[model samples]
Target: MEINLNKHISGQFNVELEQIRNDVLKMGGLVEQQLTNALNAVNNFDHDLAKQVLENDIHVNKMEVKIDEACTRIIAKRQPAASDLRLVLAIIKTITDLERIGDEAERIARVALESFNKAQQEFLVSMDNMGRKATTMLHDVLDAFARMDVDAAFEVHQSDKALDKEYEGITRQLMTYMMEDPRSIPKVMDVLWSVRSLERIGDRCQNISEYIIYFVKGKDVRHTSEDDIKENVL
Candidate 1:
């Protein structure tokens, strides 16, 4: 199963690397679609759609497992070092985050369905915005990975700030409503969970961006400042 970098170095290794990249991109695409569908389910208050999202989560999970196994096999057989090893490791880490993002989407969909009977229209609008932002971030992160565009990946990292601001704004508005009328507590709680789920999804996008940086530059940028990350973006 070993692939010697020195022997047949020109053609076979290049093709193998391309296959790895394509496989990772395929997995990323599936996770992106799941996030999009989950967001739509939340915004429309479509319990049937939400149920479908929940059921299809198993597929996403299976994809994650398969991708991880593929990466493991490549690393074991290819004995990739330096950049190649980093790319394989990044795919492994990124897929884990993507799978978690899918899990979060499913959690939000479940909450949306559970509150379908009681959710108020006023709160749905804010939740819809949160869902949109989360899905957009996920999409951007996956695109960055597919292209290995460091600048685009950094853009995805910085974009988390907006999602956080939106979540904070929603929190304040919901708190105001709850304070004005204690009867809004239950609905507000559901909205809180939905917003939290979206916020977590944004955080996962940041994780993906970090993995992108590591894959490209062999650096760990997590917990680092934006200025530092921007400086490293090439």
Candidate 2:
């Protein structure tokens, strides 16, 4: 995860770049923990754990603001060009995705406060599985960002398709559950929304992985197919 940012002529500029990079990683770390805690809270039905995740979200938001300000200052004063400029831009976009991911985690934590009947609880097992996968994707993408590993990022980008497939399967299962037991529709909808949050978190992780590739290769891979992204990365 150690990146060499010592290539700049101005040591102070190098330090500034490195500082913002470190801050982004810090923000990413917090977001990762938030997702993990939120998933655990839902699976265990821990109201206190869920409440703690909501409280800690402000810290994630603050980190995004702080790092964003640092990037603006760099752009205003340093006027970084080429790779340096790309790095700053990527950090800006990455933090935005991370913050949104935090918001999704908050949303999932809120589901922990809701009540579900024993029959409705079975669906949560599927949601928990999806949440764990989404959490892993987030962690891997953050690792790729820390190392600036384009290959790792590419792998993470590819992983999202499988997550999407899982989301579809779970949604179908929930729909069938509601059709069979109309009375459970309300509680099932809450679980449905929570799973949707998990799916969105996977999308956010994929976006972050794309940012990693964009920084290293200066290629905009968004809205591109897997074959196209593979060509760009390779």
Candidate 3:
């Protein structure tokens, strides 16, 4: 009889762990969709869509709060230890990063709306590409976390180098535009700010990847080389 009861209790604990994992994934999905929508709004110059993205940020913030509260309750009541503690801690950290990503996307959309009248097609295309790349990085990092895939998480960090290169290119182009035409200076500055926000988003994605590595391997991979990541982390 005691053995059966122990088995049942173990099953219940497993179910709770699954529930926490699902909640984190759902939060990630919401943030990803927000980023996609924000980019679409910028590309299409849709003021209404931008407004919608801004409005939905409130929902993301609420989810972050609720998830944090739930995680706290689980820790206090369940008294999870070791790997279980690591998993819960990772969820808490990831959701915080996801919520910030949502805020960055919303800020970009707001900037898009403000400069919609002045923005040129060429600049808009570049910004859209950057947004897409950043969002893809975010999605991949979340996937890595969900599966505890260290290789996939490392991919996100490598991809961030590409994002940095793109951001530098955009910055150079914007600087040239501002220097060549005095009349274009103000609008170019707005575009520069938008691109800067996107670059920061990429940095956050890299941070998320590092967190995933830590969660899986119990090692901090931040500021570490790819070779070191493999040699030390693996």
Q: Write down the TM-score of every candidate.
A: 0.89, 0.97, 0.90
Angstrom error of the Cα, residue 47, model 3: value is: 0.7
Give the residue spans of candidate 1 off by over 4 A. 1-13, 115-119
Can you rank all candidates by TM-score, best first? 2, 3, 1
- lDDT for each residue of candidate 3 in 133-215, tens digit (9 for 90 to 100): 89889889988877777799889988998989999999999888778878777777777877887898888888888877887
Q: How much lDDT does each candidate structure score?
A: 0.81, 0.90, 0.81
Least accurate stretch of 10 residues (summed lDDT) in model 1?
A: 1-10
Q: Residue 223 lDDT in model 1?
A: 90
Superposed by TM-score, candidate 3 places the C-alpha of residue 185 at a distance from the truth, in angstroms, of 2.4
Ranking by lDDT: 2, 1, 3
RMSD of each: 3.6, 1.0, 4.2
- Summarize candidate 2's per-residue lDDT along 1-234 as a digit string, tens digits: 568664877889988888899899899999999999998998999999999999999999999999999999999998889888889999999999999999999999998999877877797899877887898899999999999999999999999988999999999999998999899898889888988998998899999998888888889888999898886555
Query: After best superposition, candidate 2 residue 205: deviation in angstroms?
Result: 0.8
Top-lDDT candidate index:
2
